[model samples]
Target chain A: MRYMEDTLLHHLHTNDTEALKTFLFTIEELPLLQVFTSLSANEKAIVFRLLPKDKALALFEALQPTAQHHLLRSFTDEGATEFFNDMAPDVRVRLLDELPASVTKKLLQSLTASERDATNLLLGYERETAGRLMTPEFITLKKEMTVEDALAKVRLQAREKETIYTLYVTDQRKKLHGVLSLKELLIAEGSQLIADIMSHEVIYVATDTDQEEAARLLNEIDVIALPVVDRESLIVGIVTADEGRHILEDEAIEDMF
Target chain B: MRYMEDTLLHHLHTNDTEALKTFLFTIEELPLLQVFTSLSANEKAIVFRLLPKDKALALFEALQPTAQHHLLRSFTDEGATEFFNDMAPDVRVRLLDELPASVTKKLLQSLTASERDATNLLLGYERETAGRLMTPEFITLKKEMTVEDALAKVRLQAREKETIYTLYVTDQRKKLHGVLSLKELLIAEGSQLIADIMSHEVIYVATDTDQEEAARLLNEIDVIALPVVDRESLIVGIVTADEGRHILEDEAIEDMF
Candidate 1:
């Protein structure tokens, strides 16, 4: 306990706005988040002001729409711009979906051209569809690649990808063919082609599939991730295990009440 | 993913028994547990054989009385002894609560003295109360320690305890006083005393409180854990966030169907 406390004190003393921002952005601690939510508006604003711009934006995106509106009203124009611009397109769409049309219009106008297009595409989808939850970040793999080459490709693009754990295999036209895990590549003989080991017995849901269905499929299969495809069977994104677990947890809570 | 397939194959080959045991024990994934009341004798026996001895016992204990009787008749003497010996006292009590006195007497004869005593104690309580779920695994802390010292106590005892995230504070009389999080201790100054950092505004459910009430209290606070106490405010056990989340998810699934 003493060691844990000392380490914590050291981090606290050395912590800057960047570290604090990162912590706030990826805050998985529900109890702390609840406590923060229950704080006075002024207190929340003070905490918000202390966070880095990007962190503030991410944290704002994660907040409930009602809380977002309350916090937005407190922010200056510059803060609001930073918050809206830094948020992911899908999250922004959800926030817009909840706001009055007038407010959403004003908020949409604040986004960059690319962001606006992304937000609009997501907003066009029905609520609770795969399209609404899907992120645009994914790496597509060519089926001809050797296991070593595929691993190299993953390593190069891994930083920007949502998950490198499961890689989707595609053909010349980028139509989904199979899925592979990084673990298989590292242990297999490097000479072995990805085509030899790729799981052709692939399971996926269409982009228009209901999120609940996607969650159920993931749970039933016990896979870490599931690919999301289009009508043409082209892999677009992956719905991660963590996201599926969160959906399950939320659904469970709803049932209990 | 080729990599995931290889890793899964490797795991499956190396740990077949453990894997089979895990599959059999997870009631959350299996529909058979819910349909036990309708299963034929041969069908029940098939499912029972797939389970490890301990889990078979747990599943047997969890069954409705009529189902238990039908299933028990199918088991050989060795299998019945293994099942009876491994069953938890609280579960055994629930089984006994619904069975006829003659049958209950035969079952009680199979239990060890300690198991029988525990069964009797739990049977005296109302169903679904804190006393039923309380497993006597909680670690209590004296309120006089510094935050650093208190955290050390948690680390030393964490492995044996059910949850280390929320530490229950107690007085000289061993009555519950407050609760503290490891997160709080990490951020607080080392010189700070336990009372200064501890959250005295703790919310708890009494021994007689319903499971739904306990679940609601956990949800309302957004904490991953809650302490259960008796009427005199003595800490009995802690209900973890994961368990609460599971309860909520199960309830949601029930509503969905």
Candidate 2:
């Protein structure tokens, strides 16, 4: 840890963004988090700012809400606003819930309309429900689409979606239909319709389901992500196993406190 | 658990092979393992024989060596030979080590030359070392290969490989040079060289490294698989996170006993 801190310090002093990016990105998340926690607020800000945008977003998302809030406090308003706007809606909501009401309001106002709406959509759910923790950023496939077309759509949305490992299939009306993994898609014939290949028995949760229950379902099924649907059975979002683990970790920490 | 057992019994009574496959495959592995454990030896054999070949292999791989041994004893010599031949080399080695010397030798005789050689290769390594716990099946990418070629190779080898989630970049002499995820390969331009996109800093273990330490490194890196190299730095095999977890679990169970 000390070696890492010293290496980072040297990278900082030398202004080596390439080496710094590689150094920071290559380190394991838990160890990196420890290093960040060990640094002063100013040092934390410097390190965070120096990270490439994607790496910064990834590191920021890995942080607990409390750590996120503390780090956000050290950033300039512009930096803070950009980070808030860029965060996945579910993660942004967690951070917003940690901030003072006025600060939350200001941050929410700074978001683009789409992001603000997405954030508000999540906020509408009960605090401990699956809906509140799921990211709305997911690629849904139509059962009629060929595997080739579905793969194209997945690749296009891969940058924005929370996960492409597990894909959900739906009708035009947004009714959940089937689920298939990326590996399945990769192995299937390109001309095959998604409905022909996808498993009809998709294991999923309703929006109102308890977060812990949803996490358990995710773990039980051993899939990358679990779909969350509304009362109408309209697919709304997906909760990743990572998010589920985080929710459990946060719950455990709260219990400890 | 009772409900699951009842469902399995119903499937078996009705002789519903298709329905049984769906039922067994859809259930979580942990719960399914529990159900298997609770069954009588005859019932277990019946249930095991009913599973689709692929699902049977998967379930067999998930069981601890003791459970695997118990299950194997109930299988006919022909069934046992086929199962032994199909299993990943590392897993086969573990189960083989548990059998009495004569039975192990007979089983070894039953294996195809390739699988027999692979098993022998792993057996040569010291117990509780990475070499003894890594599957020899892995896809390696050359640095000069285009992303398109790499993707094609990955798709071609996906089924046989232990994991397609992490791909290793290696030279002609099989020296591991870099590493990249499938996601990275998917997102990169088709014309780009693998060398340009892969991370030069690969996290790996020596073949002789302690199994527990190798598992720790795999966990620390958060990759699906860790490449294992020989003393001469030649890529030998890969140890997956699932295998690492199983090793840890078996160790814990051993400690308890």
- Candidate that scores best on DockQ: 2
- Please tell me which predicted candidate would have the highest lDDT against the true structure: 2
Q: Write the per-residue lDDT of candidate 1 for residues B205-250, one digit (tens) a residue.
A: 7656776677767776767477776545666556665556566767
What is candidate 1's TM-score against the reference?
0.35
For each candidate in turn, the TM-score is: 0.35, 0.54
Residue B179, model 1, lDDT:
84
DockQ of each: 0.01, 0.31
Every model's TM-score on chain B: 0.51, 0.54
Q: Per-residue lDDT for A18 in model 1? A: 45
Worst lDDT window (10 residues) for model 2 chain B?
A: B96-105
Native-interface RMSD of candidate 1: 13.3
Docking class of 2: acceptable
What tens digits encode model 2's per-residue C-alpha lDDT throughout A58-150? 677787878877765555434334434555656444433222222233333344435544444323354678866767666789999998999
lDDT of each: 0.57, 0.69
Number of clashing residue pairs, candidate 1:
12
Error of 1 at B248 (Å): 4.8
